[model samples]
Target chain A: MGMLIIIDQPPYGTWAGREALDMAFALAAFDQPTSLLFTGAGVNWLRKAQDTADIEQKSLEKNLAAAPIFGIEAILADRTACQRYNLNSEAMIDGVQLTNASADLLGQYSQTAFAG
Target chain B: MNQLHTLHILNKTPDHPRFSECLGTLGPDDAVALTENGVLGLVASKALGLVQTYALESDLSARGLSDDNLEAATIDYSELVNLTLQAERVISW
Candidate 1:
């Protein structure tokens, strides 16, 4: 069964990104199929320009990059959310897919994890 | 077997209340995990009595809180990992 991850936290300034990465890593480590869906403020984590060095927070882009490498087959971000937040597909990390909000994608998952 | 619903709440601000509302949608046997800024809600022991609750110990400690301050049950990362396996469906909001 597929596991759905809803990330509502942004990349920097909080533990949300790290927690999401941890969960993703765990799912990948176990060879479980996992999908990530970015919603609410969490869509900002996909912004390509994130630089946490000035704030001393660890960069999560590496984790984002590893998603595809780890066999996570799908990465989705809310299209309306991205537009509302002034984000573009260009802003996201490579390999992330953009999709409008729909229940079909979510309904397929047997489990969903909300990582804020 | 019944599909378990596990809700992981990460909201911290009491004023912005959706987690509590989401609780109403929970089945009686569902599990709730308080992590990140959501630890604040873990202190309302009277409120969480009816539900199966868990707080991330590392998060609590990072916030300078101990088990003494938590109203719900607290568990380690391993426990949280175990819960994920035990639960048939894990939902986070």
Candidate 2:
């Protein structure tokens, strides 16, 4: 069965967003079909210009870019969330699909997980 | 069958309660890795008593910590990826 993880928190300020991504990778490592959907402030994780050096935190963007290597093929962002944050596709990492938050889209998965 | 293992990635400093709390949940066969500020946990001379204990090399250097002073093995990004793949579940604290 496929698992969809929905993340709604921004990265770095709190550990929730990073922890959620870790869960997705962990599930994928166990041979479970896993996907991630970024919404709300979570969409910031996809931005390519994140500079964590001043904050002394490791870059979450680097980890997000490595998602594909962990067997997580589906990385998505909520369309409205991008507009809400004024983020364009060019500003994000390559290959993160953008889609609306629709029930039909969510229903495609066997189980849904969230870290807020 | 081989038992499933859980990998605990601690990204917080040792001063945080979750740092110690996470250790109690580890199985004898589980593994732990300290990254980011969590690498500070190794400063204390306590034995983790797990199958393995690791500290991300990049994080250690970023924080100006010397891997030579740590009790855990130093790992790179590739090893971090491998550790996650080797575990059935991962908890970041």
Query: Which runs of model 2 end up more than 4 angstroms from their true locations?
Result: B1-93
> What class would a CAPRI assessor give candidate 2's docking?
incorrect
Docking class of 1: incorrect
lDDT of 1 at A115: 83
Which residue pairs does candidate 2 place in steric collision? none
TM-score of chain B of each: 0.76, 0.85
Per-residue lDDT of model 1, residues A18-75, tens digit only: 7887888789789999888887657666766444443345556666777888878788
Model 2 lDDT tens row, B1-93: 345488899886544578779877878778888886676556432756454789877665543344235668998878998989988999887
Tell me model 2's lDDT, rounded to 2 decimals: 0.76
> Under the 3 Å rule for N, CA and C atoms, how many clashes does model 2 have?
0
C-alpha lDDT of candidate 1 relative to the true structure: 0.67
How accurate locally is residue A62 in candidate 2, as Cα lDDT from 0 to 100? 82
Native-contact fraction for each model? 0.00, 0.00
Tens-digit lDDT string for candidate 2 (A9-106): 65665788888988999998998999999987577677665555645788788888888998996999999877765567776788899998788888
| lDDT (10s digit) by residue, model 1, range B12-89 | 422236756756666777878877556545433245556677887765544334424455677777888888888877
